[model samples]
Target chain A: MTTLPPPSPRKLGLVIDLDTCVGCHACAVACKEWNDGGQFGPLPDRDAYGAEPDGVWFNRVHSYAVEPGSDHAEGASNRCAGPDPESPAPKPGLTVHFPRSCLHCEAPGCVTVCPTGASYKRAEDGIVLVDEDKCIGCQLCAWACPYGAREISVRKGTMQKCTLCVDRIYNETLDEEDRQPACVKACPTRARHFGDLGDAESAVSRLVAERDGYALMPEFGYRPVNRYLPPRPRRDAANAPPAPPREETLDREKLPGVLRWLDRVLSR
Target chain B: MRPTFSILCFTVLSGIGYGAWFLQGLAWAIGPICEAHSAASGVPWELCPVAFWTKAGSMLALLFVSTGLLCSLGHLGKPSRAWRALSQWRSSWLSREGVFALLTFVPFVLIAAQEVALWIAVVRAGPDGTVALSGWVSQGGLPRRLLGFCLAAGSLATVFCTANIYASLKPIRAWNDRHVVPAYLSIGLYGGCLLLAAMTVDRSMEFRDHRILLTGTIVLAVACAWLKHRYWRSIDAQSSTTTGHAIGLESLGTVRPLEAPHTEENYLTHEMGFVLARKHSTKLRRIALAAAFLIPALLAVLTFVLPRVYPLTVWLALASGIVGLFVERWLFFAEAKHAVMAFYGR
Candidate 1:
């Protein structure tokens, strides 16, 4: 009547600090690199070098300039400014970089809609997953998900999603410090953190309490496990002196060959 | 709620079939007790041939139901891989539907076999002779009664399965409600009553039994109409899940998207972006009323007023009612709003 070893408790989740993120897509690239090589390999890119470049990425950072309660002549108040070049209005106090991924919702509609039982949330850790062997490529689960988490793998004819770098994070051979998700590790500004929110003493738990983190589309009642800290107010840039004109800028022609090459690459 | 045409056809057709069976059963249960005059009055009770006709109706009903089931299987992306659907009976409603549908077949087959065997035995025994068989290995009375129970159980189970399929969808606000089950059952009853009216109405202009069926059909039809109207009104009053304040975009207050995700329609757009215009929906509702309720009601009233115009009116009303029900079922799926609409920024 005895059973084998019980499933491991690995509550993989993401903690995004909106204050530090600069809207750069480093975490997205890191996620693609790690996921493409590890368990859910090769997130197929359609027309990578073509005119319409589209592919699946586990993480996507959306940039928005939020103006907090602006008293403008046009009667625009609390409006997110359009990212247009022609706009001559004063800049917003805060620019937000929102990175979205699977929240790993406790009440996952994706799993329940799967006729073949391919999509399921792990009872052990609450990580939502799709069983490739059982999937029938119905795409019903994708339709069921409000977050747009599931992406169809055309080649495999099955749904794929963020696994939070499960294979790498759980690897015993890797060092404890190096076992975090690829996105969390690659966050240059240290905006992304990975930990179990279930544990009250966890880093993510502590941060959530301190920052008053919010979940995306809370009215949907998905009860997303991931937490997003709101962006802090911008510093007073009006008092600071403006930079020198472009014509009076320091000459780059006198720089070393290596330095010039580095400049060119960075500029590109 | 992705409206597979197969399922729509199945529900509509099976609704008629089950409705016909239910009406016929009701007639059978009540006809003997009440000395109600059948339209075919000249035809004797022994030679009335009601049993044979009822059996035929049952066969036709089961055929349509099975055809619907087959069509539904086609909606599955991998039909051969559908076996795995039965594995998650513990939590999944789809699994429950599959299991119940298969289980319903046992009784359906039993009813068919028993009825067919009884017919064959009757034919073999001749008019007057008592056909006798061995004690333990013989002609059974229990089989016929068991067949009745099976047909009743199967009919109910099939309807339950249909209701559960829609009711299980959590994202669709229209489907995930207490009203869905009752609405489905009512539609099924309406479809059955129309079928029964068509079958019982005398071809040579007989008035008996036509009024009762017509009245029953009208009541069901009107109830469906009322329910549908209420459902739509409720949905209209409901607010969007996403608000301007929630998205941090209060300047363009309560914004609806001018464009969709892609230039060319993707899977999500194709599946969920089906928008029936208000004018078209209004027109369809009128048509549904004419076919499902008005025609049947008029025919029922006409049967009492002009007894000579019985069969033609009843048959025409039934034919129109069925077509109307198909349209109604289509609207039921089309009108439903999924919670995912919030993500689309609708």
Candidate 2:
């Protein structure tokens, strides 16, 4: 039952705009508030009042200091610096706030790795979820997830993860605008956009194309439905073009007409 | 990779248990070959009485296995829902391991039951040796060869499943390697041979050529020791991952953690962000190897030279071997670096 489903037409997911995210953690808090009262309600907590407080939450945010300029290990990471100079020579690092959650991968190892028919992906919306009733809580799904999406709750005796707000997203009773995920609704900067990514013409899909949105850890080949729109290049750096390649044929007029014709055909 | 006690206990006990079973099976299967060779040599050789050794060895393996399984039960959050673990064998290695482990019990139970019945038969035939129920209860001879085949197949497959469970995990670089499966197989075999030699040398006075058994064990120990050393060395040589690049911020230069998601350690940190100190891990590695391989091999040689101290030597060897396995398994979990650590600055 944990077997992956065939490719779905409606790959409903989020497109997080990293450039606009203020690292407020509003969405993260709202996610907990909404989910704690939803179907997978009241996320388990342990020693809440004790010295070491621990609990299960669907979303978490990480803050990273990114070093700008050269020495980019990955090709995708090479980008020009920001235009606004805080100083004559500013530090080469920019603070980046990263939010971590389930990617709703096309080939989710968490689902396949579950020994029980608990973890599953809906064919209709491609939202990966867990059935608490069926989960044995072996934590194998947690072990398999590269994104650290799954969380094991000792109190509930089950593994919990991002449900993509299935209950709220499809609820007919709620206002149409408020029916989206708690995280998206809570994002004050409007950095989070949710829609069918599989539909190439969808607003989210178009945003992805325009912003050059990319999947995280594409090398792992999970083909995550949720895409992240990378932070934009710095203002001045975006406009500045580095030294361009020189013209190979400096003396175009000096070349023989026959040779020039041959050259043109070869270049074409 | 937090070195949880339940999982550590499970791997240590089951690894040794299954390893011993594999050896027992090998001994049984190869016994006939030895006999034939002896016949060709015109020595009219006699084999050490393996009936008692086989029985005792199988029981010891079963005891360790049962205890290991019980320990794993505590690790699971929903123990009552444990039955659901067997439902996904088609895609899950854990399920395959569970199914294989259950299948393996059949052979162990059969062997243990037969051995017990044989002992009971011996007890019933009083000093006079003629008070027994004759051939009724002792109908068939212990089917060592057939049962040995079952033991070998079942135990090895189970170990493979265990190894694959870790090897298939793409997140942990240390675990998701070609070396993992072979390492598990090697360590399992090494542990088994150690247990077999310990039990055999301790319990037997009839084994004429203790040299052969001891020598084989010594070789395996030495080889296993070298393999573990190389494994540790290789892991050390590898460099840290380019995390700045991994998080899609490489162009920004170096990526460093500015703040963690939580003020205190959370589940992800507790579970995946384990980092063992280099100096301490190196020391532990040496200690584990010394106990598991070096000491056991030396003890085997010592027994060969001074058969009088055989009991002390073999028991000491067994104790040390078990301790070594615990350390080895602990390191396997503790030393592994998870990919999720890229975000947490592990």
Candidate 3:
């Protein structure tokens, strides 16, 4: 069974909304808290009190500031800015907070590169996992991973990675509402959404369709089940008459043509 | 990219060991032509008896290979679980390598046993005035021929498997190339030839065809150096795949890393983000080239200048070759930039 399994029918995964994320790392903290006592618990730390402190965490948030007009060539500055080619205007840049974990890719390179039959991807749910007992901890799996998902725990002397909170998601003992991944449930901004992406009618799929969700490093061809919604372009809202006071707009629209029209627009 | 000591030792030492076994097999295939010119030249064996050399050479090869295998095991987190590595040879290059290296021991043992038997018979038979070339290397014998063939095939396959381990990694653009296997093969041959030359010349004796062996070593050493130079140049001129392209962020804008996920170093950064100073690397490369190839080649030429220099030159060649290979192997790992490092902005 070292060979890869056929594609799973139910690609259960998460979709993250970049526009709404505040980069508070609540999800990352929640993930550590739950998983520490879950399947792969006590995700150990070393030299905690020393100058160099290192530990393992399934979810890690990375912030990136996409500079304005950095991608544009010299003369094409205004030509390709503002997202759409027709806009012909530059847009202000915004920082994006990326919380990364195992993508549970359909073709997980980490799984295929294992010398021992330690790493595997589940055909039922597309969750990539490591068999701790079987792993020789050669760290080759980490090398094969393009997203830096695989981590070797020197303390445990085995490879570990995000299991997508499998222990909780399928646990029938827990209440139905609490069965979701720890990160998704604890996200304060409600930026994380989880559902079966393979289902056409799934809410996550609809969000993906609406928000133009994209795969990270698609060229690597991992075909990650997770998707990220890019930050929306800022609305300029530049052209407008000065608004009347709030109390004045609330008054009845009995006025001259311009005032009435402005009141109506403001009220609506 | 971290250039761990165990791995550098394993790759370089094991390569020479396999190369030696393969050449011995080739000599077996070619019959007594290899041994005829040696003992018959009335040359004196200044080291030990010729039988001792035959037995000792095979032992040295086994020692090299076993030490290398053991060194590699040290790098594994669970050395006790190393047996599981052989399970996935059908799909994994590393699995295939473990299988092939283990399989090579069969032929290696057989060849060594044959040499031991021959040596014992020679010792019991006493100093039979003329040490007939036909007495030792019975190339026409069916058992020896078959075993030699197996040894050659097995050794070559092991080398190929080792090379494939690096070449199969798609993320390492420098390793995944046509140049990798040939570089490994040629270098293995060169290192093996140096070992062979050193063994062929007995410090207590002189060999007539020692010139031929050392000459072959020179040729192989030069070939190894030339191929390595070409590989280095190719990698230097190569335009590596960018992080922007890796992340598919080129279409959006310059994909600069705003911050690392962790403040402290993780396994990925420690292993993949290994960086060596350019000036130090260049200095090391020079030392490796001089020791591994240049000095050996020059000493080999000096063997032609006078017969007295033959044994001394072979010893120097062997010494320099080992040092050179070690430095070269270190550079191989140190210079390699893993694709995963792109995320860390390495």
Candidate 4:
């Protein structure tokens, strides 16, 4: 059963926009909160009140500093000037907030490497999942995965991973608007988009195409379904448009009615 | 990768077990065929004290194998459901290894039973400490030969499956190396030779009588030494996957970790993020090589010169080989850098 199912056309996956993520970690928190009591309940934390708290999490966020034009063989060129001659345009370093999770790869090694049939890919939706009942918790699937998506729960003695919120995505109990993955719904910046990536015309697919989204470590050949949109060139970059003037004051009229009232009250 | 004690025991102990079983099978298989030819020429094949020692060795081999299997259970989080692993032999190498490991017990049990029956049938001490067996004891020549060959083939095949479990994993560049399979096999067979030499050492037989076992030990020692050297050299030269590619940010320059997702080490880091100092690894490698390959090979050669202390030398060699192989196995897991570490900015 660990053998991969035939590739399905309805690959439900996510496309995240790196340029919009603020590294707020709301998505990761929301994921933990929703899944804590959902179908995959009790993501147990060891030493909850003590030092060195650790637990299983389906999603995690990492931030990195990306320096433009510093990817050369010569090494980091953080202070190097932009191409503008009249103005000394110092190239700025960009901090990219990266959220890591299961990519639901078409050819995920995690499934194939599983000794038990616990880890499997759904032929219906191309979503990878683990059957806790069958898992021996050998953790080989975790090692097989290059993404570090799988985690073994010490309390449950079974492997846990991002299910893409399978319990919520298709659940009729929840309102239609709230029936998507917890992470995708909780992103304040609308950075995470979820839909059928297999369909070329899907919004997530178009967003990927317009933003030039890419799979991480494609050289490993997992053929991940989820894609990440790279951070757009910063305003100070040589080819980017000129920066706009700074805003000196907030316009109360432009703010939403509730926010405007709150602003006025805070000002008083 | 973290070098868990249970996994090290499983691989090393089982490796030595299969090695001894393979050697025993070779003797059983070859002895019958050669005896068949000798009997056709009206000559009798003498039964020596080695027959008793060989049976004892077989029992010891079974003990090592079973203990190794038991140790592997400690590695599983859900040990009770370990049998579910045998359900996926069609695709999983680990499953295939489990199936083969279990299947190998068949030939072992069958051969051990045959040995016991033969001992029961021929129970008489001759003048020169040689046991005389009835001529009819050599009956069922083809069946015994077939079982013997099956035993050898099964032992090697199971070891092959075990090696493939690590070699097939593509993410760990160190484990995925080409030399891994051959290294496991040569080291395992070499361990078997050491065990056999120690167990089968008879005072009645001349030290030169152990030429085959000593020669095998020396050959495997040299082979394992060269294989491990090449394996280490290859892994050293291999460049790890870059951080830029890991995060899909290679177009931007030199990505560095600004902040980790968690304050404390997570399971990923704890499991696959082992770090070994270069100086420590180099020292350990030298120690492993000296104890495992150098000392054993020297002891095997010394058997010829100091034949009086052959028993002592072989036992020392076996002891040294097991300890050295344990260290080498630990390094095998400890030094391997998993690809997931790239995301952690390792």
Candidate 5:
């Protein structure tokens, strides 16, 4: 009987700070650039300039206007709401920008459903990957996933997903500073972080403790490796600004000719 | 999920094949008799309507079923490695399916051989259309009986295998229930009835048996419709496991994401997080009905009403029914909501 190798203990993960995020898509672009050039083949784009545009990206950011009453904004007060003393008004709505990617769950459903054993979690870091040579393009694993993490590469007829920049993270050639994921390195606001989540004393672990981090769709029980810090609430309603006037009432007529010309140029 | 054509064809084609085979077997077992007379009176003994129609129907059904089974194997990346699938009988339903499907081939080939041999013998015997076989012969009476048993057993086993494949998925709430077994079996029954009707029309057989088959089809169709409706409704009522309360603080009665997890779409978003509006689902349901049940039922009725116009009606019904069943199967997979969907914040 063949004895299976014991699973490795390394648990790589991401820690995201909701408080500092500016919602810039630099991380997404950086990820695309890195993953597209790495060991995995190029991610092809279909009808990029057409009416229906679709392509592969390792990271995607979503903007949500969360109300104070919503569950996602439960602990956090609305930043849009004006700070007022003794006012019974509910917290004003705030636009929360969230970035989403594969959680690299502990219990990955995508790995198990593969009929050909093409999809498997790495014993070293628990990173899920598809062995393209062994994959028949059946896409059963895509159906089995709850996170919608897997996408069928139309060109390759094989499933593709976020690799967490696997080649870069483990490369011995790269310096320690350059070893992090492309997304983490490119994050403008330092919102995205990468480290070993399994280590309690790790920076990601400390951030998780201090910030009350949350997991996306924890109900899936996949136990994603990524952690998201709840958005920090803006204190004091007195510091808030009033709503902007309607567009029709704006004083467009008072603008000078040069300013109007500049405005038109900027608008275009 | 990314739709795999191989699997789609397998389910639809196999469904048609099994239906035809089962009905054909039933017809063979129960000789045709007049409903009004309660006897075989006035029925042409030489024609043997049920036997003739069932045999013809099953032949046609086998063509599609065999092709479908073969095509599904193409989905594997390493086709040669497919033999390994049979090794995991205890844990994997997919492995079990492969074994049963492979086993089915033997019986199907034997039955076809037996039927062809019998036909050739009949032709060689001339005008009497009679051929006698001695028990002592190796590939004669005993072999034929063994082949028949294999065919029947294999067909039933295939159906069971297909059902178990879906039923085994514990995470898919809609597929995991007890209803899956009966629903799959009924689909087979409905398919058999359609094939039986086609064969009867082709052979210009008696109208009475066609009527019984049509009635059976309608009953099965209605039962399927009810079961599907109930399954959808039940799923809708169930609360998601990932409730706002589960996360700790419950100030908000309902928790919805204020911001998505990412700016760029990831693997999870493309997979389990698919959302189709209720309106579109209803529209698709109507289309499925028109394709799968309504048109076929009407055709079956028309075939009974105008026996001389049987050919057009039978062919049209079969074509429409096959297409309809395909759409139905597609929806079966598409509409099924997994418990894991709750994790995607669906």
Candidate 6:
């Protein structure tokens, strides 16, 4: 049962837009709250109010400062310092908030490494899942995953991870609009979109094509279903022409004699 | 990558157990070739009237194996459900290891059971009386040879499965390497030779007289030391994946974590974020090589020069080898950097 299922033609996954994301952790919180009370209930926190509050979460938001001149850089960091007249200038890196979770790959190492056959990928939808009953909690699946998606539940002595909200996505009780992953539904900016990525005609698929979305660490060869739309090029770097020479350039003649001398010395 | 005590004990103890079994199997299969005079006892090894040494050696090997298997259960979160692990041998290396570990017991128990009967017959015949060889449990017989082959093949295969469990994991570059399997085998055999040498000090045995065992132990010790040294060098030279790759944004400018997902340690950080200082790891590596391989090997060589103190030196070698292996195992886990750490901007 640890063997991967045949490729699923209908890959149900997410496509996240980095340009639109605001680094808010609402998706992460919603995922935790829904899962804690849903089918995978009791995502326990060991010390909720104590010094070391440890708990399991299906999603986590990481904020990174992407510097300019890198292969993917659009321009200098968004927070780079303005022209400074005094001290040495500092390059403030651009912030890119990344929400990390399971990618639900077509060939996931996590599913195959499980000794207990607890981890498996669905042939119908390509969604990877764990059967808690069969899991001996050796944590080998966690080690096999490059994405750090699996979390060991110390209290239950079992592995926990993003299920893509299986229970809600197909629930008849929920309204049609609400029938989606908790994280996707909770995104305030609509940064996360969910659909059958396997179908090119699907809105999510077209969105991916238009945005030039990409899979994470494709070199790992998991063939992840989920895609990420890289942040769009910044306005200044995208279409703006070179700025006209500043007409009001500083004039040394109008400066005091001491100031003009200081400027000359500094420039030298 | 955290070096849990249970896992270290399982790997090290089982490696020694299997190593001893391999050597014992060879001796059993060779039949007449192992007929060297035990320096401690005046009788020849193969023609010895009493089967006490053979019986004790087999049982000791079994004991080490059983202890190691038991320790491995501690690594599972749900130990009660550990039986489920053996069901996936078709796909999982860990599962194959479990199945083989259990299957190995068959040959060991069978050999031990027959040896017990042989020992009883020799005891009842009295020290001066000669016990008939008969067809059963006869030295160099077909059945004995077959069992010996089974034991040797089974032991090596189980160790191979164990090594593959680590080597097959692609995310942990340190474990997923060409050197891991060879290093494991060499270390296991080295530990095994030390165990055999120490077994000679048993009260029933009189001398440290097995030349092959002593020489094999020294050779394996040197081999293991060199293999581990190479392993350390390779891992040290390896470059890890960057934060850019982890976030699937390598083409973007350099990625630096501005904020961690959590304020306190999470499971991923606690499990995979283990980082040993360069200075500390280097020191530990030296300690492991010196104490585990170099010193033990030197001690084994010294036993050959001072046959007067063979027992003392062999025992000392085994003791030092065990201590050094523990340190090495600790380093093996502690120094490994998991690929997931890239997301943490580590």
Question: Highest DockQ, which number?
Answer: 4
Q: Across residues B96-136, which tens digit of lDDT does each residue of candidate 5 receive?
A: 67777778678667667666666666678787556564442
Q: Model 6 chain B: which ten-residue window has the lowest total lDDT? A: B201-210
* Consecutive 10-residue window with the lowest summed lDDT within model 5 chain A: A1-10
Better of 1 and 3 by lDDT: 3
TM-score between model 3 and native:
0.86
Interface RMSD for candidate number 6? 0.9
Docking class of 3: medium
Off by over 4 Å in 6: A70-90, A237-239, A242-268, B35-52, B127-129, B202-209, B277-279
A65-113 per-residue lDDT for model 4 (tens digits): 8765543433333235435455444334789999999999999999998
Candidate 1 chain B: worst-modelled 10 consecutive residues by lDDT: B133-142
Tell me how far the alpha carbon of residue A115 in candidate 2 is from the true structure, in angstroms, after superposition: 1.4
Taking the tens digit of each residue's C-alpha lDDT, what string does model 1 give over B274-304? 6773337778777776777777777767766
Best candidate, TM-score: 6
How should the candidates be ordered by lDDT, best one leading?
4, 6, 2, 3, 1, 5
Off by over 4 Å in 5: A1-9, A47-53, A70-93, A198-203, A232-268, B1-10, B22-51, B66-99, B120-181, B201-215, B235-277, B280-291, B294-320, B323-327, B330-346
lDDT per residue for candidate 6 within A1-268, as digits (tens), equals 9898878789999998888889899999999999999897679888989999998899999999887655324333333545445543336446788998999999999988899889999888988898988889999999999999899998888999999999999899999999999999999999999999999999999999999999988877888999999898766564588878877778899999999999999999
Give fnat (model 1). 0.15
Clashing pairs in 1: B19-B192, B20-B192
**Predicted complex 5: CAPRI docking category:** incorrect
- Candidate 3 wrongly placed segments (more than 4 Å): A70-92, A236-268, B35-54, B123-140, B202-209, B240-243, B277-279
Tens digit of lDDT per residue, candidate 2, span B1-346? Answer: 7889999888888877888888776665555654554556564332224444555676788787778777887788888998888899998898888888789888666666655675676677755574343332231223655666788888899889988999898887778777788888878887777666666634444353244557777988888787777778777776655667567766557777887888777878898877763437978898899998889889888887778887788778889988988988899889988777787777
Candidate 5 has a TM-score of 0.72
DockQ of each: 0.15, 0.51, 0.51, 0.63, 0.13, 0.61
lDDT, each prediction: 0.66, 0.79, 0.77, 0.85, 0.66, 0.84
lDDT of 6: 0.84
- Candidate 2: regions farther than 4 A off: A49-51, A71-93, A237-268, B29-48, B120-144, B201-212, B277-279
